[model samples]
Target: MDNILMKNEKFLEKQRTYTYTGYNLTIHPHKTPEVYIDFFEFILKEKFFLSTGFRTYHLALHDLNYLDVNNKLTGLYGSLVRYENLLPSQFIDLNTGKTPEDLKLNIASNIKYKPTFFHFIFFPENHKIIFELENERSTISYNVVLQFFKKILDSDKFKVKFTSGEVHTLTSFKRVNSILKNKKLKHIEFLVSRPNPDIFGDLVDETISEYLEDQKAKNMTLTLTAQDGKYLDLNDNTEKLGVAAAENGEVKAVIENSNNRTEEISTKKFPLNHPQIFGKSVTIRNRLLMAAEKLLPKNKISR
Candidate 1:
């Protein structure tokens, strides 16, 4: 961790993640939105968003504007996500002497990792999108998490990882930073030991295909570590989990011989909304998101 991050004691305690929960959204567009990336930049250029209700966020090519797939407003990527009270607050850009708007609302956390959703993914190097989902239970949804990664593969944006001049590395936060900066999925508990002998290869391949679909890539090696069990079916549940991920993607089939087993970790995926439960445990954290967002602009964290 950077010394600056260390100095921010709270950052380390939370593993560089502050709690952000509410009925937020992780918008997955079925069709590209009419407002393209360039257009988004043009609109927000020279402006800033005083964040209103989310905890954390990051940006990709643009400072704070990420264009969702096809540019449509919002859609659930996978079957489900960490469907807790997590939500991201919204804000918009305003001049130094002006105030910004606050946009906070409920958004279902249903995007999950699955096999069937590989149809429209675009994996750009360092830009693989993920679709983790939450369910009725309080626990996180690992199956939905798989669906999230699968959706990223469908986006065809994964190629950005190897687009010449695009230096890549697993060690550097560059790759995953966009997701984090954009508040796509924070509190990601990266596995200490990755399990490479796993069959999630299909998921990775799917991401590669979408990323490299229209254009040629630098043919770079995506430096990924198969964390022993973070995204694996640790309870010898690969076949079952794989089937679930696939089903969530609209693949209405079960694991034919899903007996094959593997070890993976469990991750919780879901969209966040500020003022989302405001449970006793997260009251202080909620205050932080609201206060920081007030400093920034609402609607600034748009993808």
Candidate 2:
């Protein structure tokens, strides 16, 4: 028999351990190894970790070409991979014999199974007005939703009216609520059957501008459900909305026919966890990077 060594002893000895999110990950050939072998070994380790611990590991691919390689690795184990500037791609177990595209479709189907809820909170004095909008038919754009709310806020019909022996409309919310304190009317309800309807189109922009300027009502919380059914607090100053989850599932905003009309766009059930604002489509991937940046420490993240 011939003495044949498949593994390099020096390379194996040089394995380096790195800490990410309190997890210790060991990388083989600490310095640098053949790209194929390095990625293969990394995938194997990730598989082992996931099976035993069931935690997601973040792997940063410095080169764009590695995306193709990562796609290939999906054959070994099917885990969700959120690549840079790419759609949320998936890799599945080899036994399933399913392609990444198939996994994507499966994910899309799962997203459609559940309804999404957008929760908003407005604080007026000691009272907190909570509004939860449900969408079961189609996705609605955040701008359009904001516009809808703006229309309601600016509408005289929805405004606080004093009918006690006199018909008077109060400009200040605080004053109106004070007079109607005993009425216990805090929430205003509206029905939105369509996105960016012609009814509230006029008051959309103006109300958003006024609402943004109002210091008293500035303390508002906006939360949107993610594709995973977990609510992501989008009101974070850094995580402003470009595209977000809607009642039905997730909704995107896009310009229609180069016209000023903005439309709410939804595709089957593909929920965009993080979407960036592009020309007419919300297909860009910068939003995911921004989200990762906010979640991970500054020193731990790389470009």
Candidate 3:
């Protein structure tokens, strides 16, 4: 055999993580369809400049493209940029070892700026919108973005309120409690695993502990129902245990009440994210649009 030496090497590719938070947007009832279209069109060309103390910030929309074919428009895609005009006080002379104050800098003009970006896709037919923030390194938050949106709508004299709420990662217990708050819980079904002496601390009752040791059961399915709208009052410890299991995704629960409504509590944090390769061929906008396309359902739009 020839002396052929092959060396194995490990390579790590640079990847960007993208997190898109889902939202439901409802146009104000008073605003007509024409008015809504006009408002969005106006914002496409508008640049919002706001100042906080000495720092001036800019918010603007860019890359306004429509998913239209043969004069039928269905969706819109764009990016929101939030940047800050760096004040003279933020600069320092590296070679001269002098700060802005030492150099007697009194001008209000700024020459440098830092920016944060958020990409969004909107379906006008269904009022479904998705937003992906820049990166985790950016200090800007969704609340700040929401404020800018509201400010622009107000400044543009859009009368109707634009309300947006996120679809969050919520626990089943939280959802159940929220929907049935102050209402009678008529039925409930949940699964509980056999108690582990090492894990269940005070949660495992004396009877359950003995039962687990003797029977060696793996799990149990409990279904409780009240008669004629009566409430099933669960003990505090049992409820706590169920809730803990639900948070961990170990419990499957179904509860029905007279006051049950289709709703979920929204949060600002995006709990889901995906990693992708960042390279020359794939731009940030392209990556965002690609991610947004996967979230749309075929029959989501009514028309």
Candidate 4:
């Protein structure tokens, strides 16, 4: 009995490590109210609980626990539950050593399901979320997360529109810098849409702003490239470039190194917000709070 217990403990220890990815979510209310209702308050008042079904699985949020930072409410730790029904065809009779025949089987008798849990944390203050790729089984994909949120919000009568971007860090930038070191900038492109005023304040040029207003254009694209092997030193505007690349637009640049090797670099290549790993030693609530500590701005962390 002791030997069996020891093997089970070893197996669980090996399965503890998990990777979590982060994303920023901006929520919009249905109407332009004088004061926007904070998400945390809204959830509390509404007693929000997501329960919905998709093609193959039913998804729901379960075992939710809220966290407070410095006496202020901030985020929550929860488990996403996915339930998939088992089909009769998946079963094989031991005596026959063959698959179960559909005609001979009763569909209602085969009403077995498997439930999976993917633990996650969300900080409403910054709208940052960290999702565990897996607990011990399959991964909850990015597309699934997006769709799940959209459906839940829609059911609650909240606006479902959201802008999502992968967080990148300076480490990702260092890799790009190494690849294009001493390279000549050959081409650059920027695609901008209805920029969020709160985040893109004063970043848009006067001329471009005027053009957008006058033309009432939904979006605009700008391109610049060096001619005759000339170097375009656009690095001087890194501040504006970073904002444009991250929030307002997608930025891409092509460069040619001295060895005649050309490579394409984009703002997307920068790894700003990297994934984090957690072992079983960390509790679900602490895992969520720790992720918030790392991603949330210092000033916002407390408040």
Query: Which structure among the candidates has the greatest TM-score?
Result: 4
Q: In model 2, state the lDDT of residue 48.
A: 17
* Superior by TM-score: candidate 1 or candidate 3: 3
Full-model lDDT for every candidate: 0.26, 0.24, 0.48, 0.53
lDDT of 3 at 87: 56
Which digits, one per residue and each the tens of the lDDT, describe model 2 over residues 1-303? 122343443334432211111100111112222332343343334331111111232212112122135453211111122121223343556776664554443243113222233322211111111222222222333323333323333434323321111011101222212212212222211111111111122343234324433543321333232343222222222111111112111222222223534333332122112222222222113222232233222111011
Q: Which model, 2 or 4, shows the larger TM-score?
A: 4
After TM-score superposition, what is the CA distance of residue 111 in candidate 3 from its true location, in Å?
A: 8.2
Choose 1 or 3, whichever is better by lDDT: 3
lDDT score for candidate 2 against the true structure = 0.24
Q: Candidate 1 lDDT, tens digit per residue, 1-303?
A: 687776776444432222222111112221233222322233235222222122332111112312254542331121221212333323334464433445455453233222121111111211222221121123232333333333333333432421111111111112222222321121223221111111233454344334443344323221122344333122223222222222122111111123444222221222231222222334332334343343222221122
Clashes of 3: 0
- The stretch of ten residues in a row with the least summed lDDT in candidate 1 is 162-171
lDDT: which is higher, 2 or 3? 3
Better of 1 and 4 by lDDT: 4
Better of 3 and 4 by TM-score: 4
lDDT of 4 at 128: 53
- Better candidate by TM-score, 2 or 3: 3
Order the candidate numbers by lDDT, best to worst.
4, 3, 1, 2
Candidate 2 residue 23 Cα shift, in angstroms, is: 6.1
